[model samples]
Target: MTDIHPTAIVETGAAIGENVRVGPYSTVGPNVRLADNVVLESHVVVAGHTEVGAGTHIFPFASIGHKPQDLKYAGEETRLLIGKNNQIREHVTMNPGTSGGGGLTRVGDNGLFMMGSHVGHDCKVGNFAILANNATLAGHVELADHVILGGLSAVRQWTRIGTGAIVGGMTGVEFDVIPFGSVIGDRARLAGLNLIGLKRKEFPREQIHALRAAYRDLFDTEDGTLRARAEAVAETAADQPLVKMVTDFILEKDDRRFCTPRSGE
Candidate 1:
């Protein structure tokens, strides 16, 4: 029960699963694989070695599985893996990986990539994430589950955004963001916890309070280095998983700095 418009081009080697639809002027490349119930709207181009999971819907003008924009890429075989139930909106451009970046870019289930959002080469995007209009991830960025990038935001290469974190509109995020963190500013800085998201998720009030306290101790106090403060908080909030999420993220080995509250804020 697959429907492909007469004007659409499905290459000979393309794999189309059950109940799939390819709209007018769209092109499915030879190496592309569309799973069951996938829909590609008019004028979409799915190329390279890309795989779209079942139940995903791609809107018009989306350029999926394009070659990596990296100059280092020398026409090597790479792949873009998009998970199930994702909504990829118009003008979204997602590129595959490069040989330098392990040759794979992965997106997890239930993501919403709004218009003009770009997923760069080798990026790892987790489940339930949303990238607002014009939001962009540079190469090798990693977004943990439930992360949200507001409109016009851009993340620097190699930065990792922890689970449940949200980056506000128009921000340029150069540093890692801790789990459940809210960050905003032209140049990003940690604002606070994502209280609204936590409440929506029904996180326990006690756990939220403990996480808040631990966040204060970790960031507000200027008595020690971030790592030392995170270690202390880890010891004190050892039993609180929510608090531990932040501490563990801070303690994890990485060369990049993380977003922190503004001085004297």
Candidate 2:
């Protein structure tokens, strides 16, 4: 029971699942697969080796599953995998991965990608993430579940944003962000804990209090290096999963530095 507009063009090899809808002027490439309950609004172009999971809705002019933007890309058969229940708004662009980046760009379920937002090639976005209008991720970035990027924000390539972190508007994030952390600035200085997000998630008040304490210990104290402090916090707060999440993120091996509080603030 699929509905395809007369003006739509679905290539012969494209797989359109049951109950899907294709709007006018949209194009589905031969290698594209639209799962059950998918909806493609007018003027959409889903190309390359892309798979749209069930219950996903794509708005007009979304150039999804396009070839990687990298200069090194040479017509390789890379893939873009979009998970279920995503709302991809107008003018959003998502590219497939290049051979150099494992040949895959994957997005998890329930993401809200606002207008003009871009998910660059080779990026991995987790579930429940929200990319506000014009937010962008460079290639090779990793965004964990429940992360929020404010309008006009951008994440640098190779950086990782841990779960529940929030980046404020117009920020340019060049380093890893710890779990539940809040960062704001033109250059992304760590602001504080994501207290609003934590509370919205309904985390226990005691756990939230412990996490705040650990945050102060990890950043406010000047007694040791950040790694040393994170290690100490991890040991003492072993019973706090949220605290451990941040400490583990800090301890993980990565080439980039992390966002830190600015001087005198």
Q: What are the candidates' C-alpha RMSDs? A: 0.7, 0.8
lDDT value for model 1? 0.96
Runs in model 1 with CA error above 4 Å? none
Residue pairs with clashing backbones, model 2: none
Q: What's the CA error at residue 214 for candidate 1, in Å? A: 0.5
**TM-score of predicted structure 1:** 0.99
Screening candidate 1 with a backbone cut-off below 3 angstroms (N, C-alpha, C), the clashing residue pairs are: none
Each candidate structure's count of clashing pairs: 0, 0
Per-residue C-alpha lDDT of model 1 across residues 134-228, encoded as one tens digit per residue: 99999999999999999999999999999999999999999999999999999999999999999998999999999999988988888988889
TM-scores of the models, in the order given: 0.99, 0.99
Lowest summed lDDT window (length 10), candidate 1: 247-256
Model 2, 77-135: lDDT tens digits are 89999999999999999999989999999999999999999999999999999999999
Give candidate 2's whole-model lDDT.
Answer: 0.96
Question: Residue 180, candidate 1: how far off, in angstroms?
Answer: 0.7
Each candidate's lDDT (Cα)?
A: 0.96, 0.96
